[model samples]
Target: MFDMIIKNAKLRNAKDLVNIAIKNGLVKAIERNIEGKAIKEIDAMGNLVTPPFCDPHLHLDAALSVGDPRYNMSGTLLEGIQIWGERKPNLTKEIIKKNAIEAIKWEVANGTLKIRTHADVCDPRLLCVEALLEVKEEMKDLVDIQIVAFPQDGIYAYKNGDKLLEEALKMGADVVGGIPHNELTREDGVKDIEYVFELANKYNRLIDVHCDETGDDQSRFVEVMAKLTIDNDMEGLVTASHTTAMHNYNNDYAFKLIGILKRAQMNIITNPFDNSVLQNRTDGYPRRRGHTRVDEMLNRGINVCIGHDSIMDPWYPLGKGSMLQGANLLMHYAHLSGYDQIYELYDMITNYSAKTLGISNEYGIEVGKPADMIILNAKDEMDAIRLMSECLYVLRKGKVVSQTKPSISEVIFNGKRENIDFIVER
Candidate 1:
């Protein structure tokens, strides 16, 4: 009498075997034992079933375009920018759409069903925005793709940058984005934040700024972002990504900014994989960690999330479009080794990230919510992270979209035959 039924699922907040019932395209019921039949049924086999992953910060315009013109031999953010600049001019709409869809396929298969992708709108052709807008419509049913009209070049640096950004918004971009630290000066950076907020308010769209992604402590545009968010009453509607500069700020200034961030109720997204490698290239001997205060932010009750910023893009040469990998990297970079912290890390990739994208109400595994979730091979949160567990099933709109079978290997050593699975037990 339902759409689908999932049995023997291991829910995070439950102890006994939980069953889920789906009707229409939403979750109908969730309890210890669900009755009734459905068109389709899946046995979870006691695997962890949680909400689908959401990546709040990703660059789809330049995804999988590494070394198009040349490699970033310098291994610095500036050089990567230069390389991307060289590659962008040669991008056509078809090319961008093809690669962007390919990248989306990779992410969707990996259980990241919702994403906020930034498209560079500084080009005169606006090819990236056009391509992503089309992709947004093309992939609407399978996944939720929100396009951010990102000005890779400073909004004030180029003569018609502001015009180009507005043009993209008029073309149906969903969010307003900016890179303030790349501006010509600190004052220009602050002004860029204002321009972004103004456009966000004008269009009534979400705001996601690449604020202070550099390693310099003076790149403090996050403070201005927080102030604008608070003064404009846009709390919980704005997100600041890749604020790696906070790692270099003094304790006094850092704590002061934290208070403002808390007051603003703004979201923070840290790209652990890319920021750890792209930043801190200029320092010698005692190099910086080049990551934001993620642990501290979580402790302060700020909505913090993790993202796979680049997938073989100019900024980061190596990425597999996996959110679990991103969370594992964050666990190592931010020293989140405590038992509770690891569970929090898992939430960063799933629930908290959904909040950052402003899609929490329709996400998560609860009755009366949309059934968008994934079943992983692991039994618990820490086990999932430790094994980078395989997603056995991915459901969207109460329908199965992807499924993977776990691998098993037979070992014959010293005349002893043993079976081995991903989880090794003594």
Candidate 2:
């Protein structure tokens, strides 16, 4: 017998309705009409159904902790980092776990089933890493949380920072992370990349670093990371988050860098919302957008993903962990508004983000894949993005994990219009 069946779902690319049958946590079959009975059946009402969303970049340790130690009065990255440094000393496992769990629940409720979060490992206590590790195990049934052992402070700036990173991996971090641009010197920035690569190789873990997250054109750590990835043959396994310097690089330099990035096959993640606020602080007139070369990167065939990066955290004070909102803002700022480009923007938050997280095989809606998907109250992909559709139902492994009813309203404009009720089903 089938475990569950969803009837009359409008898939992302399909023009007609189809019924999906789930068995033993995997999609068993997809057809115009499913014949066999199941333990549970749901009528989708011809709503759009597709794979669950994936948020490839976030900070679990700092998530939902805005204004804890103190509000970011300056609203700058450096001030936020300083505030975080102050707050880290007071963090405990209970506090960290409580906030992290709350954030994960918010994400699941919003239809994000997969996430890659950076846990600050600069502190020797390792409270963030330990808390996130436990949270990952506890939330395994609802969400897949990949923790990166990140040194929010520079790896070389903090005492025994390298040792702390190793300890975090030993405690079960999924990826190696660093802040190369924050290092003391250019030499230290280069050395930080080497250290991250070595540790990733030694532990057989994935690499994701905060490379050149500033507007300074001299922040060239991204090149160092790309070269190391190519030399070490670690393509697809390495991700460089927030290469904001790419926006400031001269066209000639950027063109040269593109070749290196293509050769390495490394992924790029841009946080349009956060960077838009934090960057361009020093500019007066006609300021820059503080985003990466998304258009250029896409044209060059270098994998690029968009991320929320933060939600109500010190770095970014406003966000709801919604990938749709992220996609909307990114599409506008990145100037990707063409008919096909809009669809590609959707992929940045879904398929491409999954690839960045190394979860492509387990993230789609194909047969034999895990039954993780969301039902949107929209007729098609374009409508979904246009309306910012709400997830009426979210299923994880054939089981309903979260759901919400759409809002309905009745209004009378005038006697000529008459009184009519409008049901807003999401």
Candidate 3:
């Protein structure tokens, strides 16, 4: 007998309805008109059934910490950093684990099952690192967590910050992280990138840097990262998150940088929701959007992913840990609205984000893969994005983790009864 069976669901490319059977936390079969007696079965009612979302960039340590030290009145990146600094000292294991667990619950409830979180390692105590490590284990059955030893305060700026990063990796960080643009000087920033490569090589960890997260035209650490990736031949293992400076760079320089990035096979993550608010603070009129060259990067064959960086945190002070919301804002802000472009945008949160986290091999909804997927109350890809579709059911490892219901309303119009379930087919 099957452990669970999902019936009458619309898969990604199948022409007709299919039934997915799961047993022992693995997708056993996906066939038409399958006869099975399972412990549980869900009728999808012709809604879309696809893989769960993958959030490649987020700060779990800082998540759910809004208004703790104080609200960000200036609405600038530096102000947010200051606020986070004031709040970081009081971080205990219990408090960090509580907030991190709460954030993961929000993500799982919204159909996000995989996340790459940046844990701040600027403090010598490594309290955030240790707490998040515990949180990772606690939530492993429901979510896949990849922690990065993030030096939010700048690796070279803080005393023994580099050592702290190594310690975090030793303690069990999946990736090595850096914030080079936040360093004291350009030289120091470059040095930090070198140190990141060294640490990753030393620990055999992945490299994901908060590179060039500023709007300054001179912040060229992303280029440096790309060059380093190429020089070290670490293709696909390096990700440059929030390269907002690419939007401000002159075409001459950016055009050249894009080629280098393409050659390096580096991945780019644009947090449109948070970056649009945090960046370009010093600008006056004709302000910039404070995002990376997503279109250009994709055109050059570079993998670009989108992420919800902050969730009601000090950075932007508002978020819900939903990748759909992130994809929606990104489509509008990046002007990716074409039919094909919208489909690609969908991949940004699902497949491409998995690629960014280096977890594509274990993600997706195909048979024989891990039975982690979500059923949405929408008909097609566009319908999901257009409605910001709620996940009717989220299954992690073939177990139901969260569920929501679609609303139906009937109204009498012009002496006729009308029913609306907001189901749109494309």
Candidate 4:
């Protein structure tokens, strides 16, 4: 007998309802009906079943610390940076670990099983790194947490920032991170990219840089990152997060740059919730959204993913750690409501993001793959994104990690009570 069996599940792009059998923490079989019984069984009632969400970019060290020192009066990126600096000196390891664990729980409850969080390494103490490293070890069985040695302050502009970053990496950071556009000068920015690539190569770690997260057209560190990715033979091992400047680039330049990105096989992560409000803060009326060319890049066949960049952090004041919520906002700003595009938007939160974390090879709901999946309270991707559906059951390695009851809606119309669950009579 199998360990568990999920019945009457509706998978994406499939027509018929199917039953999946799990055994030994892997998908044992999938068919219309199973011959034998299992230890436990769940009736999905035709709800959608998909892989767990993956958040490729986040700031865990600063999560849940939005107003510790003070609220961001200006609500600009620079103001958020200043506020974070003010609060970092007063942080304790216990406080940081507590906040981080709370945030991770939120993500897991929402079905995010894989995460890549940036731990600021600009401090002399590396306190966040030490605390989060232990958190990662403590929570390894529940979620896959990959910590990036993030140099939030420019590596060259901040005093001994590069050394601090290296120290964090040596102390057990899983990724190397940089913010090239935050450097003092263009030359410094170039040097920042070079040094980031050097560290990545020397340590054989993945590179994920916060590149060109500004409205200025001249902020083009993404191009530098793409070049270095190709030159270092690390094309598919690099990620460029928040290339918001792409929206400001002229058509000619963007056309040329997209080719380089495709050649470099770089991963692009867009944080719609944070960048929607954080970016274009200084612009006047008719200001454009602070985002990359998501639709364009997606068309070019480059790997594009969405990130929940902050969770009650300084940069963004609000987040619930739900990738669907982020994807819902993305559909509006990116204008991706078309029939086919909605599926693409869903991919941004799941498969595309898994690719960013280099786990796509073993992810998904296939035979012989780990039974890591979530049953959503929606029929398909469109309804899920539209309703921001809850995860009815979150499973990890064939065991249920978290579960929620599917919501019910009752309406009293024309003096008669009825149950209406948003069904369309087509």
Candidate 5:
């Protein structure tokens, strides 16, 4: 007896299909054939079944706020920030909660069951923090949400910014976040990292900083973060998101910093969707890379993950709330198109992201792990990314939370009607 049984499922990279038995909200058995009777059963039909996707970085508070007061005229990061600042004052608790929940629903529909969202806490009112806390609790059954107390303006540059972030943590924000690269001075940026590390230590929380997100080669705050992480013995608990500046760093400096990142066990999160547009805004000409050295870091065995970062927000005007879309973009941006590298891209959104969120223990679909997974229309990871494959079924705790059909197209070929499945055959 089981809660649900999924048959003929193609687990990632597996050559043969296997039956999965779910019981007591956990995966009870997985084998070639299983004797089972359950209230519900799923026929995967040799489609890919993977652990639900996890997005470790997103701004829920600012989601769906594109062109609210005005559009980003310059299409630059600074302009986007200014537009977001204008919209912040008029935001109410009701508005934030409504928009965030809608964004969460979009992600869930795309098979993202776990997320780490940054709630802006630069305002003394802490409106975004309050709103997202409520969303986290209300949506607990629908998704696992971890709220980060993000100081968007600057922890040290903005007056009382540090205090407001602390208040958000006191009000139950899960992770500590900061933006060191945006500070007024290089010294201020250093202090920003120090303060973020101090607060993270004080609160016994994890750190996720927007460090060196700019294209300027001199924005070297990521080194400061790594050093502080090592000195504080907080290795593996710190993450530096959007280190796009690393792409402009010289080979020697970049190599040295990568070593330090390895020693600190710091997680690096590259937001392809947001940074691909935001970075290199100030560049005049020549080869200007907007992202970090992802291929090099992946080759170095550093724990690098991907983030969507923005969704129809001021920073990014386009988003369909799909991690596969993000990964597909990354596959091109990071030059990860080889057969093995394509498989690795799938891990970036799931396993690597789970590592960033510190949820590896309960994040997978193995036996004894929670029965939370998604059945994709694609038979493998390559098709999943190539087609942005629809998730036919999404389950949480052994229950079907969402289900849908993949798009199909019909056309007359040689006087006979045929279907386009979009399956790239070998």
Candidate 6:
């Protein structure tokens, strides 16, 4: 007997119903119908069934750590850093692990089972790194948590920062991370990028850098990052998150940079929800959106993914670990309201983000792939995005980890009965 079976489910790209059978934690078959019996079954009823969501960039160490000691009154990235510095000394392994676990539960319920989180390793205590490493192993069954040794503070700004970063890597951090824009000077920022690349190559780990997150047009570390990726031949293995500065670059310069990014084959992740509010604090009127050139990047054949960077964290005040929320914001800020653009927006969160995290091979809804998928309470892609659709069932390794029933509504007017589906009718 098969482990589980899902019947009459509608794929996002097709109009026909399909049956999916899972056995031994893998998709055994996908066809029009299956005759074999299974221990568990779910009737999707023509709802949208898709691959599990993926979050490409996040800060689990700082998640749910907002308004600690004080709030960010200035609403600037610099102020957030200062607040984080104040709160870092109070961190303990127990508390960090507790918060990380809570955040993972939130994400899993929203159908995000694969995540790449940055853990602050700049603290001499390395408490967050130690805690997250343990959490990674503890939650490996439910979710795949890839931890990055993130230096929130500049690597070269603090004393002994470089050594601490390398130490965190030796202790089993999966990726090498840096915040070059936070360095003391532009030249120092370049040096820190080189240092991170050297360490990543030495340890044979992937590279994910927080490059040029600021609104300064002069902050051009993305070019340096691209060149390094090409020189090191680490194209698909390297990711650049929040290249917001590119938005401010002149069209000519931006076009030139895009060529470099394409040649390097680096992945780009844009955090629309956080960048929209955290950036452009200095501008009074006609303030910049502070978002990267998402449309331009996609048009150039560059792989771009959307990220929910913060959840009740120092940087962003609101988030529920929902990729749909991130995608919705991206649609608005990026002016992607066309019929085709809406569908692509969904891809940005699922398949595109999966590619960024380098987990697409094991992710999808095809036969012989891992049976990790989600059934949403919407008929198609447009309906799903419009409703920020509820996840009816979430399956991990062919086992149901969570499920939620769709909301019900009744309408009776003038002795007439009507089935109310705002998503379908509106």
Best prediction by lDDT: 4
For each candidate, give its TM-score against the true structure: 0.98, 0.96, 0.97, 0.98, 0.98, 0.97
Model 1 worst lDDT window (10 residues): 417-426
Q: Of the candidates numbered 4 and 6, which has the greater TM-score value?
A: 4
Candidate 5 local Cα displacement, residue 374, angstroms: 0.4
Candidate 2 structure lDDT: 0.89
Task: Enumerate clash totals for all models, in the order shown.
Answer: 0, 0, 0, 0, 0, 0
lDDT for 124 in candidate 5 is 82
Candidate 6: regions farther than 4 A off: 411-419
lDDT of 2 at 318: 89
lDDT, each prediction: 0.90, 0.89, 0.90, 0.92, 0.91, 0.90
Residue-level lDDT of model 6, residues 93-185, one tens digit each, is 887788888989888888899999998888888888899999999999999989999998889998888999999999999999998998999
280: Cα error in model 6, Å: 0.6
Worst 10 residues of 4 by lDDT: 417-426
lDDT of 6: 0.90
Worst 10 residues of 3 by lDDT: 417-426
What shift in Å separates residue 80 of candidate 2 from its native position after superposition? Answer: 0.8
After superposition, which runs of candidate 3 have C-alpha atoms over 4 Å from their true positions? 409-418, 424-426
Q: Give the distance in Å from residue 138's predicted Cα in candidate 3 to where it truly belongs.
A: 0.8
User: lDDT of model 3 at residue 49?
Assistant: 95
Q: Give the C-alpha miss distance for residue 259 in model 6, angstroms.
A: 1.1
* Clash pairs for candidate 5: none
